[model samples]
Target: MFTIHAVDGYIETLYLAVYEDRVLLIDSGCRSDVPRIEEVMKRRLNRPMSQIALAVASHTHPDHAGGAPTLRKRHAIPVAAPKDINQWYAGFSGGLQHKIDIMLGHFVAWTLKYPFEMIYYKKHLLYDHPLKEGDRLPGFEDWQVIETPGHTSHDVVLYHAETQTLYAADVILKVGSGYRPPFPVSMKKEMRESIEKLRHLDVKHLLMAHGGPQQVTDFPAIVDAMLKEIDKGLPPGLKRFRKLERFSPVMKRYYRERRQAKKAS
Candidate 1:
């Protein structure tokens, strides 16, 4: 059996699944978090960087995929990512969206009163394995990857059926005692459908990128709460973040079509 270690990243909580001989990175954190991950492996775990067998990018977001290729280069770790991840930032518009996402990462840092740090990363990743729903993570077969595309079209979450624990990348966000959908619900309907898929899973522990891990009693209730928050949408005070989120091509087209449809009506 392996243990999970939490690495406090610049704007997210990164998880490392530690086995006796190898390690599995649940989600590759921001570019700025690479050294931090290496330090944790060396100092805390007392393990060589070579022990890191695989790094999984749940999505192509800066925080979720930025450090993956770096780890592969520095430690010879292979990255397992969504099959369509590279498409997120494929062209010129995608490149602009990538930069905007990075800026939003910094904006989140500023909102949390955290000090400045570099989080820039390349848009395209040299992924070794492309994952799909129900496929087990490469080199970490015990954990299963579930596609949960709402925050992003390529988002995924890992499920450990043995322990009923879920590594919910950015599917659900927590603040104090509350839970909410991620900032940019790029595909709202798909997000809801993805969350519904999760609701049917037998999950006892939930590990979140934004809020960290927590024990779940009634997983369905938690999911219901998250869905409610999504329905409520972002409040007026946080509307600026939504504006920034629209920079994504998917989000831009989503809103643009909505506006056009509203005007037609």
Candidate 2:
């Protein structure tokens, strides 16, 4: 039997899919979350660090892809992520945005009343495998990847057909009885389209990075609710962060490239 344990990460909930022999991290947590993951696997799972065979980064954001490289270095665990995941933080703007993302991670922590901690990590992503949509996670074939862009230029959610669980990364967030699209909605149209794609899936459970895990009676209703929030755009308190993020070089370039791609397609 495969048991999925939700580890309390520094900022987000870390999902660890464990088996008798090996383990898989549904979404690698923040950089500072490295030690925490290690501890959980050792003490809770009673497995050595090497048992963590693969760590998948569902997106390039700080809380999603931050701890992957370090986990690989520390335990030689292979890192897998979406195609072009690195491009989101590729050039000069990416560098600045990366630092800004680190600060934002801290800012998010602050907003959540989380005590201070180091959230820094290398700006660039280093993954052993580049996963395209529909590619089964390198070793864990039971899980399949679904391209769900919009929260960023590149985002993906893993779906387990048998279990009907969608590991929605930053693509969806549930906070205090509410569900909404991730911050910065870097690509609003795409985000909605991505959510639309998810709406069609037979997902009975949503495993979110932020909202812990949840059971679903009406998944489409939840998706529709989130899509509505996306359409409504950022609320008053979030408008500033959205503006700041959109002003970043990364977002500017993402916008230009998306515009051109739309025109071409």
The prediction achieving the highest lDDT against the true structure is 1
- What's the lDDT for all of these models? 0.88, 0.86
The lowest-lDDT stretch of 10 consecutive residues in candidate 1 is: 243-252
**Clash statistics: count for each candidate:** 0, 0
Query: Which residue runs does candidate 1 get wrong by more than 4 Å?
Result: 251-265
Compose the digit string of candidate 1's lDDT tens values, residues 2-54.
99899998899999889999998889999889999989999999999899899
Q: Could you tell me every candidate's TM-score relative to the true structure? A: 0.93, 0.94
